[model samples]
Target: MKLTKREKLFERIENHLRITARQLVKFDTEEETLQYLIDSSRSELKCDFVGIVLKEGNYLISKVWSGSCVSISESFPIKIENCSPTFLNKSITFDKVDKDTICEFSKLLLEENILTWFTVPLKDDTNTYGFCIIGFMNYVPLLDEMNRVFEEFGKDVAVAISLSRRKEVQKNKMMGVEWISQNLTLDTEMDQIVGKLVERAGKGTNAQFACIYLYNERENCFILQTPAYGEKTRLNKILIEKNYVLKEYFPYLETPGGPQLTVPLVIDLKTIGVLHVENKGSLVFTKEDEEILELLSNHVAAMLENARLYNNEKDHKQRLHHLLDYQQALVKETVEKDTFDGIVFTLSRLFSKTVMIFDRFMRPISYELFDVAEDELHTLMELATFEVYQKKNRDLWFSVDYDRNMGVWSVNGGSDLLGYLAIDITGEEIDDFFKLSIDLARNIASIQFIKQKIVLDAKEQVKDSFITKLLVEKIEDEESIIQYANLFNWNLFHQHRVAVLSIDLLEEGTKDNILEHQAKKSLLWDQIKTRVLFYDQDILFANKEGEFILIIPIEKEKEKPKVYWAKLYEEIKKWLALEGDKSKILIGISGKTEVINDYFIMYQQAVQALNVVSHRFSNVGFAMFEELGSYTLLHHLKDSSIATLFIQKHLEPLLKYSEGKSMDLFHTLRVYLNNNGSIKETSDELYIHRSSLLYRLEKIESLLEVSLNFAEHRFDLMMAYKLYDLYYSNTALT
Candidate 1:
């Protein structure tokens, strides 16, 4: 009555076949059928566990499990890292899984003490659903008879899973449609509607992350109508547009991390936006998820259309009237030359709250204090700046953890994000009238800011033109220069010095890098203008030839112009975080010139001084025209022989004797002259003993027939050494 191993397997296979055929037909859903398969298969194989895993987009997700497990659950996703679907789909055998090259999920089972497993691809004629897996508590061979039973089960389960997913799709679609139908109202903001859509879609479709993006034509970026991804705590502090590029609708591609599913929201024949989702727990996206996503996207489009039609029909005239009324009030206030603070104060009184105004760059320009506490105002400003950095787009929305009583809105003109207005409604209530007044105030403020910016820009342009002409030696006369200068409200007829801020940013010269460099220049310009203590002396700033030129008038109480210039240089270096040794920053200053016509000479001197920093004097960083001692003489000398003559007159004998040598004599002479004939210092400079340096200096002095101690002799020798290094580039020294 004892049965053989082959006979026992045969009986077991027959029983499993019978169970799958009968139960698969009777089960109402894929989940129910999968539970039955898991239970029946585990019993037939006497395995520890039976589970069904199917490919969902880029991940393998568990659908159902029967037996106990330790390491993993249904929530765990089989991440496809080492192997891709292309490799698995082309496996030689559908039933036998190569243990060495098993998927990540199989490895997890082995780690949990399930040493052996047999998985069959759950596939029909055209589609592979996933894998139907049975794990063992002990080692077992993958046999032919096992595949026969599991293959039948896979075919049946594939059908069940396909049908079950269709139901899931229908359920999700119906929910989205129902939600849209109930929420479509005349006054619903598109931003609010999109936020709800993302929330519901992520939950309903069981996605790890979801997003609703609308193409902001003005920004040339995809605006997140909802949270870009995940909860606020887990959201990436990076721009979403950088992660996802906008392609034509329905384009499928792989991201740097993995695959993503994109569902285009189209209205009529035009694609308006995108709905994107990635991962479902540990599982990839499924056909059901994609269908549901697309269906929801369609509903979103429909909702948008409905809202647009509603606004056009019902609120068009009212909106126009409100805008008109806002414009009239702004006109009345501005015609009276209301200051920025005055405007802010009016808005605060209208809303019966504190208000703060920021420029386009997020620098607070004005505010209405009106009983606001100092500590509270300070905290609000700090929080506002932090939130501004977190914004992916320029539009303002009071969506952070700041006070909900605060009403934050953008002051936009056309597509430009002009500025922002934040109203503190801490203890007050906001009605429709308050909201309307705020909208008008922000619009008026933006207009006023732009107007002021235009005037400043015009003045800057005039200043730049005048400076450029003066620097290029194109000024016809002092009168013309003064007339051009008067248009900018700047007095040029004062003793002034020129300072050149020279920065060479070494990076790959890409277009994006160029744009970034330009932005830095703009920011640095703004910072310099804001922080430079003008001190009753006017500063004219200009950008030319990839550098900044500052024509600063001399203060009446200054001691020496060079000391003041060097101090200013150090201050700028510290503020920009560009120390002399670590970063590439060279500042040059020209000596003071009294006449307006003589400023061109000072500008030339500053340019020459900055140029000398790259070529001469090892200790030079902050250079002045007066400090460039030998460089000025050497630079003006056009005759090469004249430079050679000076070198020969001072130390011709040493230069001749040092030829074909290590330039030891030239090195000894230069170091000796630099240390003012101090044998010990010269020894330190050359890393030689003092006695050796004294002996070398004696030999050199004997050869040149000059005393190294005399000031004129040392000066001539130093000039000769410097000139040799500059013109010959160490050829004559060697």
Candidate 2:
């Protein structure tokens, strides 16, 4: 049975090709097929090295390589004038004696001590797809008859590629027909279907990483999910890369880490998602794997289509079932109950369990708790982390295990999450029917919630109007103001200070009406509500003209407005600083209320304080009108005549001396005042040495004909500087 070396080599090559081809389509993706092609070729066929080079425009790009000491070019442009090897045109062999483009690449084999190499074109009758490389460590002679086997190998590759191109449409249609016959209904969950496909794609393909991205048509984005074990998938995870589809990236599958294979999930001609596979080893996905994965992805899409249809049908049935009940409940709740508490009580009795309603900000607005423990309620609250309750994260539903002697069920709204609606049933287990009922309850709750919001919104609009009218119309009658506030459910007639919170980067963050601006406002309002509610319930969260108009209660009769505002400002500022990407906020507060009817006067003072702070302390986040003192008085001045004369008398000499000078006297004076006239701070601000700033200050004091040490003189100088600022600004405008 002993055969010649040539006979043995022929038999080995033939056996390897048959074995690889038989298992080729067994792979889930092209990446698995590629890894197998190279690794199996080296091990089973006893080849020294193997690689795949794919055609890209006028270049032969080495996609992947395997084996000891082997190497390949990353890119080799085809230059017919330079006699570049066109492996795509036809496969060929190489030796040391060959004088061709193969020799340029043959040097790589030579460097690896591989003296013999052969390339087989992976092509069909019409198109040359690419080529595969097999190199030998020692020079080996090949029989002329062996070319037939190589040709057959190329045919197998061609067949695989053809299958890949067709499976997305034709094969999927057949599977769709088979799926219904086999009782695989459309009610199957899409994620479950995708997970099965992805797991198989990675494991079957022998890929290091795999990812599937389902297109969300509504969002115009793709929801990406990857094999949990795939490190590459997690490391490069994106929330939703916009405007990308699978077909666009079909031509090239190589990534920064390795060669990847992408195939589309198509059902009924609509592409739903993309399946990607990556082999950890140095190899590109093979044509066979591509074909196999295409089939796999198409099957997944068919299942997804069924799931979608099932959901639509199921939703239609539910709507039809509940139409009457929903209508009756809506009318009764709106007409008879007309309040959140009444609606909550009705829902609680209907469900035979306590239900709690959280507002959009996660605050408990209404609830009917019958037997829930306080600690248990607290635990549930803690469970609503950013990823659980926040609309931005939007985790809609979760249920605790019923067998654990405790069960907590929760669901968001039907159309959109108005708030958290949760049920407390300690001993009850949930089935499909119970889940359906809960969904129905949530839909009913959404309707009622919307109704309540409409009523509240009307009240808010009236309140906004009332606040503005009080400020502008000079509504000084305390009894009239109280009655007006009561009508809108606001108690703003009490001793409450007016504060305005302005977002500094409103235009910057929310340009073109980006949703981030609205989300930011919601988050900020929640923070404000939490802080304000901690002190007392006599506070209002409202806004007018991009500013948060807060009517905060004055807690103590003896507490100074400056001290109280300062403390509150510090606490809020600390929280604001922790907001990673949020814009800076500015707060302006007026002096505490003397009487309820002075709401207009206090609001005016708050606005005036904000203007003065913007000019005098631009870097500060919060300022009170009482603390502004002289700055506040300057803002109150209507004409610049007296202020101009005062400024000219105090610093007229210094102004004259510094006219047309490069060192700006106005900037120097402002910096000195801002720094509390400290020599070091002034020097640092002006980027000057201490001696230079000291010299300027002494000269200024001499020119002003007053000692700067006296508080009265310092006050006069500061006031004069503020007046000069006003006069200069007015003169510039004219």
lDDT of each: 0.66, 0.64
Instruction: After the best TM-score superposition of candidate 2, give how far the Cα of residue 68 lies from its true spot, in angstroms.
Output: 95
Residues 1-734, model 1: lDDT tens digits: 99998888788787767767666766556777788778877777788877777665556667777787835665456655643453334322323446667765655665687667666677878788777666777777666655566666667777777666666566666766787778755478766776777776677657767777666554455555555456532222223344454444324421212345677778898766777776664445555666777777777786766665676656666756765765676677766763677677666766667789876545677887766677667766766766665763554445224444555677877776667788776655454655766777877887787777677678667777778777765567767778887875767767778878766544455336778877766666655554463323366778765568887777732877657766776666675563122334676678787777677778867776766554454255667777778766665677878888887777678767887986468667866766777777778878888777778878888988888778888888877766665456424433
For every candidate, C-alpha RMSD to the true structure in Å: 24.2, 23.8
lDDT of 2: 0.64
Q: Score residue 387 of candidate 1 by CA lDDT.
A: 64
* Global CA lDDT computed for model 1: 0.66
Name the regions of candidate 1 deviating beyond 4 angstroms: 1-324, 331-339, 360-363, 373-420, 428-444, 472-475, 510-537, 544-547, 560-567, 570-584, 614-621, 628-734
